[model samples]
Each structure stands twice: as C-alpha cells, then as structure tokens.
Target: MAGSYGAETTQGERYRLSFTVGGLLAPQGRALAEMYLNRMGDGSTERSSQAKVSEKISEKANEKSDKNAGEEVGESIAAIRQQAIEENVLAIRTDSANRRVVAETTRRLSALTVEELAYLAGPDSSTSDREALMWIAMCRYYAIVGEFAGEVLKKHYLTGNTHLDFEDYDRFIADKATWHSELETVSEGTAKKLRSNLFKAMREAHLFDKKSGTVLSFLPSPSLADILRKRADSFGYLPMRESSL
Candidate 1:
C-alpha cells in the first residue's frame, strides 16, 4: 500500500496532503482532475514549467468559480499538481536512456472512482486507500499510520463498536512509539501530527462523528459507487470493518 505525499514545509509547519483530502472527494475535485489531464496536453506533458502550468490551471480554475473561490483555485491546483508529482503519478523528465524528455508529463494517472480519488486525495478516506495513500503521504511526514493504529482501533474501538472513544486515540498516541521505522520513538510533535493526519482529516471527510469520533458506516457517494461498480476487484475489501479507521 503506497502512501501519498511526503511532507510540505510552508511557514515552518509540517503538513501532509491530508488537509486537502476533502476537496478532492467533493464535486469540485472531478473538475480539478479533468483540468489536470487537460493541462497535460495529448499525454506528452510538455508543460514542464511550473509557472506556466500554474498559470494555465489557474485560468481554467478561475473560469468555474466565484471571484473569491477562483482566487484560490490556482494555488489549490498547483498544490495538487505538486502532490501528484511527489507521488510519481506525474513525470518531469526531459530524457532517459537517450529518451530525452523536456518537461513534466502525466506518468500514471489512474482512472479512478470518485471514492478512490477521494481516498487518494484524502489520507484516511478508507482502510484500503488509507493503506495505499498513507505510504505516499509518509514520504513527507516521515510518520507511519501503520498496522499498530489500525490494530488498536480494531481491538479497542471496534469489536462490535461502530463509534470511537478519545481513549482509543490516547491509547494509540501512548503506544505510537514504533510507527515510523526510522524514528526511535514517536515524539509528542509527531504524535500530534498523526492526530491531525488521521483523526482531523477523518472528521472532515465524515468518516467519524464530530462529537464522539464514533466510527461511521461506509456509504459511497452515488457517483463514487457507480465508478466503483466496474472496479470492485480493485477495492475488494468493501463492507470493510467500521473501525478500520
């Protein structure tokens, strides 16, 4: 299970692609994905220049939003593009093995369900994608949302339980000293980061109830379900454990 983005340092804060997961699962995300492909231009991805790609994506993004929303679309798209780049879904090589490549190109954009894309965009959307996207995200955060958290959630928060208790978080946090292979112990700062990455994003995505952090049922959006219908095998773990969070 490959994870998502690594880590991004803006104003001295360490954030993952986790913050923007909801946006990618929303209706707007479909448009964003389409715009991303369109910007690729015949799949050759001649658009290697970030400034140029940003300008074009921004223009397209502006066309579909209110003045205020439009203002942030470019930045948002650029961020997505950057994340995609980090994930290796996009390539920016001029040439390889005498194969000269001048700029960035779409490397391996998967045709995904809204749910799958959502899961990809959001770090903790589903157990399956969580496994996959979590790895990609780990490259940046240097933290692992490994089986320990999942196992704890299953044993303590799950087991005929559909909801979660803060105690579960406390347990995970207390025992999260071995998540990342490279880290000798999970630092307070790192645990806090995991909280933000896992719990916070899960809340926003409606995977857990706000007040209690209770586990939620799995209900794919209609559009997402339709997309998943043909790709069920790719996500064979449906009807997943509610506590897989």
Candidate 2:
C-alpha cells in the first residue's frame, strides 16, 4: 500500500506541474481541476502568497508616486501666491507715493493768485474753464512735482494777467464748488480723504479759517513748486525749462 501511495503521489505532482505550465504557455483554456487531492492545499497556498507579494509591491510604488506629485503641486501653488502678494505690495507702494505727490502739489497750487492762474485758463475764461484749467495744472503739478515746481511757479506768476479783483477771484472760488461734485464722482473715497488732509494742512498753515468758513487770501503760502524747483536746480533741471521770471 505504501509503495502504491508513493507512486500515486509522484504521478499527481507531475500532472499538476505540467497542467499549470501548460496553462501559462498555451492560448487555449487549460483550467485547473481539483483532481490532485493530495497537492491541492499546498498549490493554493503558494499561488496566494505570490499574488499578495506582487500586490504589495504595486501599492507601494503607486503611493510613492502620488506623494511626490502632491509635493510638487503644493510648492508650485505656494510660489504663485507669494508672487501675487509681492505684486500687490508693489502696487500699493506706488499708489501711496502718487497720493502724497498729489496732496503736496494741490497744497502749493492753492496758494497762487487767481490772476496768476488765469493764464492756465484763457481770456474770457468762465468759471468752468478756470476750474478745468486749475485741475489740469494741479494734475500736471503732481506729475512733475518732484522735478519742476520752482520754474513752473515763477512762470505761472509772470505769464498771467494778474490784475483781476477779489470779486472776480471769489467767483472763481464759487465755481470750484462744481468741481467738488465731479471730484466726488471720479475719486470717491480717495477724493474725500485727500480733501480732508488738504483742509487740515491748510488749517494748520492758516490758509483757511475753519470757524468762519473763510479763506485767507494774503498769507505767504508754502510753495512746494518753489521747493522742488530749487532741488531740481541743484540736480540740473534748469535746462529743461528756463525760469521765466
């Protein structure tokens, strides 16, 4: 019986190995059958272990690839956000500089005589024309404030018909009220903030009487134009525009 059993075992191992190898090599279906009851348990255990090992290796490779991809994407997003923040900071700085320049120019131009300002407006310059001219000059003043205030200031005083009476000047000031509405529309909050700062500066300079709602027309005003012009002369800005006075 032992000899018979050994012979059966040998035949069964050969049959099972042949069938498995044939299934891998052949294009036709050579499906496994549980005819080899003696080897069934061991064969099943070996195949399951091989499959689990392959699955673990594939899972680990996929996990590593995903982790690397996530890190790269995170770094890219962080770089873009940092660049945007830097650009916004630069823009804010530029805008703040522009506002300061405008405030300084307006303060200086407000000191000019109405007659001196008339050249900016033409002869028969209506209130609207004068205000438009003043606005233009004020804009130009800010644009060039750091470079050319003094020569421009002298030219303004010298070129205009500076003989208009106070009543005519008062009319010019009254016309400026129309500009308030226009300014409010265009600049909105910015205009109001600038106006407040300007008025405060004027008050401190004694250029206006806040209590009586009156403007003092005769105080020798601090002139940014003159200050800029002097600085420009030291830096050789005299060649740009000859001093008219």
Candidate 3:
C-alpha cells in the first residue's frame, strides 16, 4: 500500500513523527517563553524545575484566539511541549547528551532569554532564519529519532544521495525489523509510520524535496556553522553539506 506523511496514525504515530515547531508559532511561542521566563525564569536552575508552560500556552490561546483554541492540546501538552523547548528554548544546548553536557553549556545559554528561540519558529524570518530553525530542529531530531530512522539517516542520508524514494524506506524498515528482535514484524506497521513521518520531517527541513524526493543541500548559516563546529561530535553521524563548517 502506498503511504504518505501522517499515514500511520492508524498504526500509531512514530517516534520521529513530525516537526513540532511548524513555523507558525514563533511570536506566540516567544511571548509565551518570555512570559515563562518572567513567570519562572530561563536559567539552568529554572529549566531544571518544571514550569507550567502549557498553562501559559493555554492562557495565551484563550487571550488571542477564539475560545475554541483551548480545545486542542489539552492532551497535547505533556507529550510535545518539551520538544518545543528543545527546539526553541534551550537550543543553545546544541549537543546535550546528559547532565554534563547541560552543565558545560550553561554559561553559553543560561543567561539568554527563553523567548529568543521563538523567533526562529516565527513566520517572517529570513531564509537563513528558516535554515537556522531547521538546523536546530535537526539537532534535536538526532537526539530523539529512534534506532530505525536514525540508522537510515546515518547509513543512507549521510552519504549525500540526492534522492530516496518509498522503496528505499520499505527496504530500510524490513532490514531494521530483521536485526532488532524487539522491533519484529509485529511492529513493521508502526515502523512504516515512523519511516513516512521521518521523511516528512526531512522534507520540511528542506533536507529533501518532498515533491521530487531529491535530497537538497544543507547550507548552514555562519551561526549554525559555529554550532556545528562546537558540537561536531553531536552531528558526526548525520548528513549535512559540510561537517567542519
């Protein structure tokens, strides 16, 4: 059966299902973050303690939009709000693996306002701004993408191929199911959803052309290049135009 993005909802969503920062929420997200920092603060100590960010988001939604805006994401908060933070708030923590990484980078990121990252998620940003957000999102994607899609990205995408089609995805899933007993055939349906959504993300990030399936080149902005340099090992496994940059 032919599949598309979000197609596997029936099978269940994949781990790397979609980019949560949809390029629409930057202003609101930023406002919310600043409010969060004001309400809670953006320091390491503050982030270590959980803030009622969803409560703020709900409040903002009610303030700005029709009352119906409150209806969505009541179930959406706990599951995804962290990814938003990861992509938007603490993005300066580029290659965080554990507590040590977080500790080492706090000097660089701690004083920064949480709302700053929301600009990257906004609509009226530059091409470089868009690329910056995409690159930041990719940084988080590497941390969270499961073994199967991660393997495909490392093995297949890192090679710099220009195109990857559905057949390639099918083969990758079949192979992952073969090697990982925990992810046996029973989960292939779930794996299919994962694969499709992962590609959807790749497309949205401009890593590939969704219409043509052509893997596009990644041109990291100077700032992004600096992050990549600082966090080279973090990105060593993933595909990019140039690693050292």
Best by lDDT: 3
**Relative to the true structure, how large is the alpha-carbon lDDT of every model?**
0.37, 0.28, 0.40
Q: What are the per-residue Cα lDDT tens digits for candidate 1 across 156-231?
A: 3346676666567666545543443323344667655555555554453454566865765444544434434443
* Candidate 1: clashing residue pairs, number: 24
Q: Model 2: per-residue lDDT, tens digit, 1-245?
A: 11211011222222111000110110010001110110222323233353453443334334443333212111111222233233332233465553333333223233322222222222232332233223323322232221222233223234542232334323432454353333224344543444444334333333345675544332111332332332233212111223432
Candidate 3's C-alpha runs over 4 A off are 1-160, 185-189
Clashing pairs in 3: 162-215
Q: Which ten residues in a row have the lowest lDDT in candidate 2?
A: 22-31
Q: Provide the lDDT at 131 for model 3.
A: 46
Predicted structure 2, TM vs. truth? 0.21
TM values, all candidates? 0.42, 0.21, 0.46
Please count the clashing residue pairs in each candidate, in the order shown. Answer: 24, 1, 1
Query: lDDT score, residue 187, model 2?
Result: 41
lDDT of 1 at 90: 27
